[model samples]
Target: MIRTSLPLKKSLKPKRCRSCGANFNPISSMSKACSVPCAMALNDAAKAKSAARAAKDERKSLAERKAKLKTRREWIAEAQAAVNKVARLRDLLAGHGCISCGARPQQKFGGTFDAGHYRSVGSAPHMRYYLPAIRGQCVRCNRDLGGSAVNFRKGLVERIGINRVEEIESMQWTAKWSVEYLERLKKVMNKKARRLEKRIEAKSEVNQLEAVE
Candidate 1:
C-alpha cells in the first residue's frame, strides 16, 4: 500500500500587528505579532493589562469588605438620614410651615430646618420612616425645644386632619430591619430625594423670573 500526498492547506487571511499596526501573514491561526520585538511588546502589553485588571478587582473586593465591616447601627443611621432628607425636601418644596412652631420658612431666626417627627423617633422607632408623621421644622422647635409636642400635634392636625393624626397615633407596630432591607430603603429614599431635587427651582432662576415679572 502507498500513501498519497495530502492537499495543501489554505493560508489564513493577513492580520494587522497588535503592536506596530502593520499587516503581516501569520504562521498559525492564533499568531498575532509579525516580528520578535512586536511579539515581546505585545506580551508585555498583555501582562500589564492583566495586572491592571487584577488591581481593579482587588480594589473592588477591598471596598466590599469594608462595607461588610460596617455596624448595623451605621446602616440604620444612613437609612434614617435618607428618609429624613426626603421628608425635609417634601415640605421645603411644598412651602409648609414648621410642624412644631409656626415659624415661617423664610424667617431668618432659628436653627437650620429639619425633618421634624410629630411622633418622636425616640418614642416611636416603628414610625421612624413614617412620612405623614414627619414635617418641616426648625432646629429650635425640633431639637432645642424637644419637638414641642402640643404645638406639633396641633399643627399636624391642621395639616393632615384630626382623623389621620389620630390614626397615626393609634398605630402600634414593630419592625425588624435587616441589613438588606435597610440598604434597599436607603436607595429608595435617595432615589425619591433625587427626583424631588429635580423639581426644585434654583434661587437665582426664581429671582430672575420674579424680577422679570
Candidate 2:
C-alpha cells in the first residue's frame, strides 16, 4: 500500500446566524451562536416550549385513559350481571337433578360440576341466557364426554338410547333459584328487578291514561 498526504487550505471561514444576523468568529470556524448566553437563551426557550407541549399531551393522555377505564368498568358490571342472572336460573333447576341422567343429590357427587348445555347457546341464540337449557354435569362425566353437544349426545344415546335423549330435550323448568356463578347475585337481581318494575309501571300508567281518555 502507498502512503499519501493531502495539502491543507488556509481560506476556511465561518457562517453568520440567520436569525440574529450576527457573524460567528471563534478559534473553531463552525461555531453558530455568537456567545454562550445567546446559545443558552435559545435552547432554554425551546426547552420551555417543548415542556409545555409535553405537559399538555400528558394531561390529554391521562383523560383518555380515565375515560377508557370507566367504560371498561361499566362493561364488566354488565357482564357480571348477565352471569348472575344465568346462575339464578341454574339454582332453580339444580334440585331436579342432572337433566341428562336424572342423577340425585347432585352436590353429593365427589367431583366438581359445570353448568352444561343441552342445545348449545351458539346454536340457540334466543335461549342462550335461558335457565332450563343449562344442566349440571359431574366433572368426570363432563370431561369423559368432552363437554360438547355431539359428545354428550353420543354418550346419552349409548347409555339410555335415543328415546330418553328426546324426552330430556323437551322437559320444562318449574322452579327458580340462585348460585355463585358471578359476583353479588342478589344486588344484580335487585337492580334488574327494579328496572323491570319501572318499565311495567310506565306501561301501566300509559294504559291507565288511554283508558281514562
Top candidate by lDDT:
1
Mind giving the per-residue lDDT tens digits that candidate 2 earns over 71-182? 4335444544455344433443333344445444334444355556566544543344454445555555445565556655765565457887787676554422223322
Residue range with the least summed lDDT across 10 consecutive positions in model 2: 174-183
The CA lDDT at 105 in model 2 is 38
TM-score of 2: 0.30
Per-candidate RMSD, Å: 6.0, 20.7
Model 1 Cα lDDT, one tens digit per residue, 20-56: 9999999999989999999999999999999999999
lDDT of each: 0.87, 0.56
Worst 10 residues of 1 by lDDT: 102-111
Instruction: Give candidate 2's error at residue 8 in angstroms.
Output: 99
Residue-level error in angstroms, candidate 1, position 60: 5.8
Question: Residue 90 deviation, candidate 1, in Å?
Answer: 0.2
Predicted model with the maximum TM-score = 1
Using Cα atoms with residue i matched to residue i, what is each candidate's TM-score against the true structure? 0.67, 0.30
